[model samples]
Structure formats: structure tokens, C-alpha cells
Target: MYWIKLSKIYFHGFVAAMGVIAVQGCVLSTDLPDYKATLPKMADSWSSQLEYEVERSSIVSVSQTWFTPDFHQRISGFIVEGIKNNPELKSARARLEQQIAQYEVSESAFFPKIDLSGDGSRTKSSSKGPDGERIKSYENSFKAEARISWEIDVWGRLESESQASYSSLLQRQRDVEFAQLSVATRIVLQWIELIALEKQLDIARQEKSNLTEIVERTQDRYQQGVGSILDLRLVETDLANADSTLTSKVNEHSQAVRKLELILGRYPSGKIQSAKEFPKIVTDFSAGIPSDLLVNRPDLLIAEQKVIAAHHNLNAAKANRLPRLSLTQSTSYQNRKLSDLFDPYSLVTSIAGNIIQPLYDGGQRRAVVAQNKAIEDETIAEYVNTALKAFDEVENYLGNEIHLKKQEEELSRAALMAEQGQNLSRQKYYSGLIPILDLLQAQQRFFVSKSRLINIQKQRLLSRVNLYLALGGHNTPLQKIMQTDPEFSEDNRNL
Candidate 1:
């Protein structure tokens, strides 16, 4: 009786505490450590490590109108189409919804669970009395019961588990965002490549036409006895080579068109035509500080979420070794007649609290703690490696931007000179003042120079694309708001 009375008092106190918590709507009063505090130190600025002067006036993020605003706008339609149809992006969104559902499931643990049950039984029996007379008896019974069970979170274990689930949800959210960015980047690259292939095909067709005309002239000269048989053979060989080159270029152009159509989530019918011209390039942009990577990059944010989840998992594992307190209440009604089941005399009620302390579990709890710690370590390492690789990518693309520009300029001059030399050699060969070999060499040089020029120009554009991707596209409006609003910042997210 004394123990029952003591339990009642303790239960009342617990109920009062729970009432206050229910009003507050929080599982724990204290906050966990912020993820930023756990990050490794990084350089203050990106330019310090770069060889060239980077315009540091603004952080270079993915912008709608990037290095080539005109080109970006032109491709915006394609990007929109791809994002809508991309299977990977769709899958990421579905995973995000799945994570949201899972988080809700974890949160349900914080509330009481109630169950109801009903049962009815009927029996008939007959027996013989000691006096040899037959006796018969009939019996009927019914029961209805309701039970409520709640686990008290005295050690914040439930809170930690919920937090872990929430972190995973956030990770999934970031994945969706990352998928969108990736789809955009890929579409841009494939579009640029298609244009380059188209240009190359044009060059190949022109070369084939020029070689065909030369072959006709050589045949006429040879028939008129003004050119050697050897010269006619050379022209024929050149024409054949040009035909082969044109065929290869046509195949490449077709394949490029098909690849692009696929990226846009369309049928690869090899019929889509890319714009013959490239958009104007604008190269003056800034690479923001390295710290922005933590804020702007989705993969890094996902990594941070992983770390947060691992931390909570370790906490929950440790809590498993501690005592767990749970309360169960059951109310039941029983009677021979169904109508009298709920009668005051037939009613019974009971409430009990149980505290289970782990006696032994073959070191399972300790092993779980150790395992979570290892996972935490792995996430940290991966985060660091990802950051380093991001840094490297940014640096490499920036350097390529400079190098490719120089290459295009030099190749442009080389192509121009080669064109002049080839023209002069052809004229001299027609006048019989230059050997066939000299004319052939000049033509070869001209073709190679023009091809290189086209290729280098494409590379320059692609380098800029890569640079924008590496910089981690521009911050969204919500991110901008978060930057200015203290309440939305990562540090205050717990509140």
C-alpha cells in the first residue's frame, strides 16, 4: 500500500512535468552543438591560392546569366525541360518524400500509443448429479479493454533519435537540390558540344568541296597533258581522304545531336539541330571565399547532415545503456451479459510504471556506440576530402579558363596564317611553280589549324561552364534571406 501511494505521487509529478513540456512543444530544453563548429579550418580567401588576379568584388555562384549571359538564357529553356523530365531528379524528390515520412515515424515515438480490444465467449455444458439425475448448465462471458502506453524521455534518447531522422531528411532535401544543379550543368555541356560538332561538320563539308574541285582541275590538266599522272593520283587520293573525313564528321554530328536530345529527355532521333553560332563569353567574375563552399555546396551540406545524424545516433546508443521509464494504463469491463459489460461493479482499472535498467547485453550497446563513432569519423573524412576536391576543381577550371583563352587567340592567328599560306601554295601549284607535296603540306596545315581553333574555342566555353559548376551556382533568394536573417542562420536553426 505504501509503495502504491509513493508511485502515485511520483506519477503525478511526472505528469506535471510532461504537461509543461507538452505546452512548450519541445523534447529537450538544451541545444546540441552546431555543425559549423565541427568543420575544419579553411583559407580565408580563394584568390590567395590562385596565380591570377580573381575579381573578388562578388562571390561567383551559379547565375542564370553566367560567363555568357546570352548563352545561358538561350539554354534556360532546355534546362527547365530537363529538370522537369530528368529521372534522377524525380527519384531524388521521391526519396525526399520518403525521408519525410520516415522522420514522422520516428517522431511518433514521443507520443503515447493507445489500443482497444473486445472479446466475447459462450459455453454450454451438461453433467450428471450424484443422485443419477441429469444436470445442464449454460455460461456466457464478455470483455472490452483499452490500454495506453507511454515511454518517458528522461534521458533525451527519443529527442536524439528524432534529430537523427530529421538530419537525414535534410540530407535528402539537399540531394534533390544537387540533382537539379547537376542536370542543368550537364544539359549546358551537351548543348555546347553539339554546336561544336556542327561547326566541325561545316568545315569538313567545305574541305570536301574544295578537294573535289581540285580533283576535277587535276583531271583536266592531266587529260590536256599539262599535269603529270602522279599529280592526278595525288588529287584523287586527297579527294578520297576528304570524303572519309566528311563521313566521320557527319557521324559525330549525328551522335552529338542524339546525345543532347537524350539529355533533354527526348527521343534520340538524331534530327535536332543546334545553333550554328556560339554565345558571346564574358569572363570577368569572382570566386568567393572558401568558406562559402560550406554554405553554397549541397554535397557539403549533405555531409554535414550525415555528421549530425551520426552524432545523434551515438547519443541514442549511449542512452540505450541507461534506464528506460515507461507507464502503462489499462481499463477493462467484463460481464456475463454484453449489456452489463460496462456496469460499475464489472469495471476494473490499473496503471503501472516500469523502469528497465540494462543488466547485460554482451557489450552490444558499447559496440553500437563505437560503430557510430567510426561512422562519424568516416563522414568527417569524406567531408574534408570533398571540400579539398571542390577547391581543386575550382582552381583547375579557373586556370583552364585563362589557358584556353590564350590558346584560342594563338590558334586563331595560326589558322589565319595557314589559310594565307595554303592559298599561295595552291596558286603556285596551278602555275607549276610549286611541287604537289608543298601544296598538300600547306593544305594539311590549314585544315589542322582551323580544326584546332574550333576545338579550342569550344574548350574555352566548356571551361567557363565547369567554373560556374565548381563555384556552386548563385545563392537562392531563401539563402540570401537566411544570410541576412539571424533567425534563419545555421547557428540559430535549433531555436
Candidate 2:
């Protein structure tokens, strides 16, 4: 009786402690970590990262422009269609489906299990008296019953296992989200690269055409009495240079086409057309604060979920060593004949209590417990590291944007002056005021400066895209609101 009283008191204490722990779970994580808080400020304020914020854009609303129906191409839906067709994401989603099925296997233990059973036998027996000959007898019997068993989950052991399984399922769902996000980001970047290459091809073709005209004029001058043999040689040199540049651009343009086709999940053939202009990029991305980033990023959320699952696993391992209490019961009917198998006249009932404690296992259970704990610790460390790395990316982009903006302004002025200089030199040469070398020098400088300007513009646009992605909103208004508010108010951010 005294021992019974002690056991009751012990269980009560445990239940009380668990209730306290459940409440603490909510309160302990209210504050964001230092690294998470510093990200937005490091990237500059809301206006700083808002370089590409287009006025007509809506973060939540989809524009009809992104999914216009083409008569020839069956493609529709920018991201949704991309995710549907993406093989990696499809594979991940299939895996998640498989994992969701596994949860059923673990959950089955929580409910009663039933088994049908039967037994039949025929026996020959011999009996003998102390002084008499042995006598023989025959006996036959048949019995059938339905057996049922259930392990009553006490001490939350079964609940803990279910929680662990749920965590695993959740982790896989996040993996699916991660895969989708990855494919979407790749498609966007590859598409952007393809467009940039097309523009470059145009630049190359334009330069070649201009150079051809210059070469032709020089040839006409050389053929006249006033021009030298050196002038004719210079024309030949310029023509060859233009051909070489055009060849390089053609090769690059071909490569970009192949890459874009591959991103759409197609096999690359030599066929390519620069006919399609790129979709207007989303410039205005409102990236929320650093803490908000943690919620928006699928990769980080998946990582955190994995750590949470590992934590549950470690707890499960620890629980395994404790004595588990379960109640098993079965009610059935037995009969000597098949017809009587269901008759309640021969009903039988049994209830059993099981107390299982791990006495010895060659330290295997202990090792498992220790290993799981170590794994949980490592995951926690990794979660912290990933969070820090995200912070660095946001900060780097912010700093780059500020500096690149200034550089773009200066380079624009430089390109304009170079253009003017090139025009003047061309006019002077026609009047024989400048030598062929002076015009060639000016010609090279003018194109090079113009190319540099184009290159910088491309970089700035790419920076906007990358910054938007890294900040986790991809040129959406929710991102800006998150940045300005620094609080994750967007309903979609969590998901």
C-alpha cells in the first residue's frame, strides 16, 4: 500500500513537470538571435534594398503578363507551372508522399491489433495399471479464437514516438518546399542569363556592322590618291577583328540557348532564336528583416525542422531505457468444430500488464542514446551556422548595392565622354587631321567603355534579383513590408 501511494505521487509529479515544460516551450524562443536582428540594418534600411521596387508591382497578386498564352508554346504559369514540370521537385514530392505513408506504420501501434487464430489436433494415448496390460485410447479436438492485443501508452512513450514520426514527416514536407524553391530560383537565374547573352549578341553584331562601315570608308580613302597603303592595311585589320568578335558572340549565344532549353527540362539541339525578349524582371522586392528571413527561406526552415526532429529522436532514445507500462487484453471464443468457432458459449477473456525495463544490452541502448544526443547537438550547431551564413549574404548584397550604384553613376559619365571623343576623332580623320592609329585608339576605347556600361547595368539588375532571393521575397511587396516592419506580418511568410 505504501509503495502504491509512492508510485501515484511519482506519476503526479511527472505530469505536473510536463505541463510546465509545455508552457516553457512557447516562452523560451520569443526573442530573435543577435545575428538575425542585424541583417536588415547591415543591408541598409527599407529604401536601400528597394532599388528594384517597381511601382506597378504587387507582391501577392500575380500579373497576367507573367503567364500570357502563346499560340505555339504550351507554357503557362511562371512559378507554378515550373514547379509542376520540374523533375527534382516532383521527385522530392513523391518522396514526401512515401514518408507520409510511413507515419501510418508508426501510428498503428496506438490502436488495438487483432489476429485470427485456430488450432486442431488428433492424439493417441496409452494408459497402464501397475499389473495389467496397457490400454490404448484416441482423442481429437479443434479450437478457434480471435486474438487481440494493445499496449496502453503511459508516460507519453507512444505519444513521443508519434511526435518523432510527425517531425520526420514535417521535415520531408519542408524538403519538398526546398526542392520547389531551388528549381524556381534556377529557372529564373538561367532565364536572366539567357537574356543577358542575347543583349550581348546584339552589341557584338552592332559593333561588327559599325566596324564594317568604318573599314569600307577607309578602303575608299586608300583607293583615292591622298590615302596610304598603311590605311588599306588598317581597314583589313579592322574587318578581321569584327569577324573574330562576331564569331565569339555567336558561340556564346548558342551556349545560352542550350542552357535555357536545359532549364526548361529539354534536350539541347543546335536550334536557337534570340526572338523572345525576356520578361520584365521584378525589381521592387520588399525583403523583410533578418528574423523574418528565417521564416521565409525554405532551406533554413527545413534545416530547423530537421534539428527539431533530431531532438525528438534523442528524447525517444532516452525514453527507450525506461520501464514502459502497457495493458494487453483479448476476448475470444473457442470450439471443437468450425461451425462452433463463433459461438459465445466457449468465450475466453484475458488481460495482461507488461512492465519492460532494459536490464542489459551490451551498452547498445546507451550508445544509441549518446549518439542521438550528439546528432541533435550537431544539428543545433548547423542551424545556427546556416542562420549566420544567411545574415552574411544579406549584408554583402546591401553593401554591394550601395557601392555599385555609385560606380554605375561614375561609369555612365565616362562612357558618354568616350562616345563624344570617338565622334570627334572620326570627323578629324576624314579631314586628315588625325592619323589611322589615333582613330583606332579612340574606336577601341569607345566600344570598350560602352561594353563596360552594359556590363555594369547587367550586374546591377542581377544584384537586385539575387538580393531579392537571398532576402527571401524575390521582388515582392511582402518583402518590402517585412523589411520596413521588421516583423513578419505576411501570412505567406510562414508557409
Candidate 3:
């Protein structure tokens, strides 16, 4: 009979709770908007085609064209070392991991939360009976209970939040990849700069030696009464200039080494070895279509992911302006006797449902929706800008490759002619056919042309590196270029 009565009471409580939920459901209304239609669309292709040409051709492959075998090996090693040790890349990876954890946290909202609790209490009371007699009472109670609660996502609020978090996780992952690419590109460029500086130092030393020899010869001619003191002074001044230039080049080379070492995550000891000469790279830059950049570039991909995340955020914000339903159930066993707490007769259970409809919040919910929409628009603009910038960079580097090659060729011819002229002028000065001023002019022109040619060569190599970076480091095109080059023999390895 007692068990029957307890069952009736529990059934009544459940019925009452259902009645309350049904009543509230009829009165509450949701104000959420359809957010899917608000998402922005992206372009399927580039706005413009890559129009730069090389060797009178509109299309070229840059992948291995400028990457010589030695350059490929050295830069590959540096990139590997830098990716392993760069602190900025490591930090980006750490942030990715954190976002992964946050994604899981957001996903947890889809499931119910359960809690277990237990408590024991003893109470004593003293009071006077109706007949003026003193009376005392003591009581002991023990209880154990399990409670479960869940927020029903009837309007897809939790689902939208989970999607947003997942997009954020993907964005963070792209950020890490972008960091890796950036670190590798920086290492390669710094390494190239250091090598070019070393070549400049060599050129300066050679020029210094040549000027010293010229000054000695002029002094000898002055002692023999064939050269004026003014002529000897002119040669001495040139020698001093060469010495000062050599000293500056040496300092620059040292600094370049230190910069490269820092990028490699090594101590800036300035002891790194560099190539003795600039690698002979191909003049042709193989730039495929501009559309390839959208798929290949990490930064662009990251921007796209941000837009996705923002779209999800906007959905979640719109969903927040609606009614939320939550259900909770608790069951407990209670008994004065501690061991009898687990008895079926002592059990009690109750269930409840709550619906929260925001009547007023001073327009906070509307502001949140507007803010997320604005953020989505901002990310879209940034993505479009990134794509345009990438295309501009590709065009700039391709044009640079063509113009730099022509400059290098013209300068090479000038350097050769200047060398021959300097030699002939020296011979003529010894034979008393030309003045010392003429010889000095020829020597100065030769040194300047040679120095300029070396610098142009270095610039060409640097431009190739920039093209590699702008193309998102895709190297298959480069391999094809390397295979077609006559200089790439069986012994030459691809970068």
C-alpha cells in the first residue's frame, strides 16, 4: 500500500510538470531570423589574367627555373631547420591546438550534463508540550541523489555555435601552415642576401688589389720623371676609395650572416658558410594562371576560413534572440537509517522543464547580431584584398624577371668591353701613348660596370625567390623548368 501511494504521488508530479511545459510552450515565441541567406559568396576565379611574358612567351614556369641544384639543397636545409626551431611557428601551432580544445568544449553543449551528490545531517530540537511539560526531539537524515539537465536546441543555437567553433579550429590550422610557409620564405631570402653580400665582399677585395697595383705603377713612373705628382696623387686617392669601399662591404657581409643565422633560430655568431658565387638560375619565370593562387596560397585559404567562421558566428547571434528550453530531472533516496537510504521505498523523483523567452534586454541581442554581420562583411573584404594583392605580386615578379634579365645581359656586355678597355689603356699609358687621367677613367669605368653587374645578378636571384613565395611555394612547375634546361644534367638535383 505504501509503495502504491508513493507511485501515485510521483506520477502526479510528472503530470504537473508536463502540464506546465505545455502551458509555457503555447505562450512563448521565438524571434530568430533566417541567417543562411546572409552569407556572402566568393569569386570562382581571378579578376585578371597574368599577362607578363618571358622570352617573348606569355606563359613560363618559375618553379625550378631559378632554383639551381646547390641553391635548392642549401635553402631546403635552412627551411627544414627553421620550421623546426622558429618560435613564431611553434606559437602558431600551439594556438591551433588550443582552438581544437575549444572546439571540443563547444561540442559538449549537444549532450546532457549529469551530477551526483550526497549529504547527511543530524538535528536536535527542544520545546514545551501543550501541558507545560518539557519535550525534546532528535532527528537524523541521509540522502543521495543524481541530477540530469539538458538544454534542448529546438532553434539550432547550439548547432550554430558548434559550427562556428569548428570553423575557428580550421582557421587556426591554416594559420599554422601559413606560418610555416612564411618562415621558410624568410629563411631562403635572408640566406640569399647573405650569399650576395659575400660575393660583393669578394668583388671589393679584387678592386682594392687592382687599385693598389695601379698606384704603385704610377709612383714608379713619377720617380722616373715620366709621371706628374698630380697623376700619382690621383691614383693614390682611387686606392684609398677602394680601401674604404672594401671595408664597408666586409661589414655588410658580416651583418648579413648574422641576420641569416637569426632567421635560422641559431645564435647570431656570424660564422655561417655561404656559396662562393651566385647560383646560375634560369631567367624564365613560369607563372601559371592567376586562378591557381586562390587554391595554393595559405593566407588566402586562412582568410576564407575566417569568413566561414564569421558566418557561423552571425547565425549563432541571430539564434540567441529566441526562446531557450531546458529540462532537468532529479531522483533521490532518503532514510533516517543510513543503510536504508538505498531501499526502493525511500526513493523520490521529480522532473521539470524551463523555457526562457527574452522579453527585453535593452537591444543587446540585436546589437550582437549586427556586430557579427559586420565582422562577416569585413572578413569578406579582407579575403578579396588578399587575392588581389597576390595577383599583383605575381605580375610584379614576372615583369621583374624579364627586365632584370635584359639588364643583366646588357651589363655583362658592358663589363666585358670595360675590362678590355682598361687593359688596353694600361698598356698605352706604359708606352706613353695616353695620359694617366685616361687610364684612371678606364679603370673606374671597369670597376663600376663589374660591380653593377654582380648586383644585378643578385637582384635577379632575389626576384626568383620572391616569385616562389608569391606562388605559394608550388614547385612542380619548377621541376619541369629544371628538366628542360640544358644546364641541368643528370648530376644536378632538383630543389
User: In candidate 1, what are the lDDT values of residues 370-448, reduced to their tens digit?
Assistant: 8987887777777777877887787788778668877998999999999999999999988889877788889889988
lDDT of 2: 0.65
What are the lDDT figures for the candidates, one per model?
Answer: 0.78, 0.65, 0.77
Superposed model 2: Cα runs more than 4 Å off: 1-76, 118-143, 225-231, 267-286, 331-336, 474-495
lDDT of 3 by residue, 1-495 (tens): 999999999999978865765564443223333332333443453223233433456344555355667667666667666766788877887898899899999999999999999999999999999999989999999999999999998667788789879988888877876776677778767877777778778778888888788888889989999889999998899889888999999888888888877777889998988878777774454466677787888787887778777877887787687778899999999999898999999999999998787769999998998899899888888877887788788778777777888899999999999999999999999888999899989988998898899889878878877777788766643333333444432323311
Cα lDDT of candidate 3 equals 0.77
Score every model by TM-score: 0.86, 0.74, 0.81
Q: Which candidate is the best by lDDT?
A: 1
State the lDDT of candidate 2 residue by residue for 67-172, as single tens digits.
Answer: 2234113222334445656667667878887888888888998998888877887789999968898988876667766667777664455666677788788888
Model 3 scores worst on lDDT over the 10 consecutive residues at 486-495
> What stretches of model 1 exceed 4 Å from their correct place?
1-41, 48-50, 53-69, 129-136, 476-495
Candidate 3 residue 183 Cα shift, in angstroms, is 1.6
If the candidates were sorted by their TM-score against the true structure, best first, what order would they fall in?
Answer: 1, 3, 2
Which scores greater on TM-score, model 1 or model 2? 1
